[model samples]
Target: MSRLLLVVLLLANVGTAIGVVYARHLHRQSFIELARLEKTRDELNIEFGRLQLEQATVAESNRIDAIARTRLGMKFPEASDVVVIQP
Candidate 1:
């Protein structure tokens, strides 16, 4: 009976050690994945900032006016061309 109890205890200890090893492996894998995701998030944030800057540049009033004049042949009205009416 004593030998049987010892065998059972040894088996339980081995099983617990295997569980610990698996848990450690999972933790390491999770840490690596977290690092990868954080790197991707940082890269995307940089790209988003660049895109926001480009959008701001494109949306500036002077840039719009230049494009209108150069590409669309638009022009501001001269004083003689102005017509005012009471609304």
Candidate 2:
């Protein structure tokens, strides 16, 4: 009976050790996954900032005016060319 009790205790100890190992492995996997997602989020944020800057540069009035003058041959006329028509 004493030997049987010793065998049961040993089995229980082995089971507990296996549980600890499995839990540790899962914890490590989750930590790695979290780090990967954080890196992706940071990269996306940087890209978003660059896109915002590009939008601002493209939307400037000075840039549009320059393009119109150079590419489309648009010009502001003299005061004498202005005519106001009243209905």
Candidate 3:
């Protein structure tokens, strides 16, 4: 009976040790995944910032006017072509 009790205690200790190792492994994996996700998030943020800057640049009035004049062949009306209406 005493030997049996010793065997049981030894088995329980080994089980506990295995549980600890498994938990540590899971923790390390989770930490690595967290780091990877954070890196991806940072890269996306940088891209978002660049896109915002590009959008601002594209939306500028001077750039729009330049594109319209160059690409669309648009021009302002001559003064002689103006017809002013008194309201």
- Candidate 2, 1-87: lDDT as tens digits: 999999999999999999999999999999999999999999999999999999999999999999999999999999999999999
Q: After superposing candidate 2, which stretches have Cα over 4 Å from the reference? A: 76-87
Candidate 3 lDDT, 1-87, residue by residue in tens:
999999999999999999999999999999999999999999999999999999999999999999999999998999999999999
Model 3 ranges with Cα > 4 A deviation: 77-87
* C-alpha local distance difference test of each model: 0.99, 0.99, 0.99
TM-score winner, 2 or 3? 3
Residue 86, candidate 1: Cα error in Å is 8.0
lDDT of 3: 0.99
Candidate 3 minimal-lDDT segment of 10 residues: 73-82
User: Rank by lDDT, descending?
Assistant: 1, 3, 2
lDDT string, candidate 1, 1-87, tens digits:
999999999999999999999999999999999999999999999999999999999999999999999999999999999999999
Candidates in order, TM-scores: namely 0.87, 0.76, 0.83
Instruction: Using lDDT as the measure, name the better of candidate 1 and candidate 2.
Output: 1
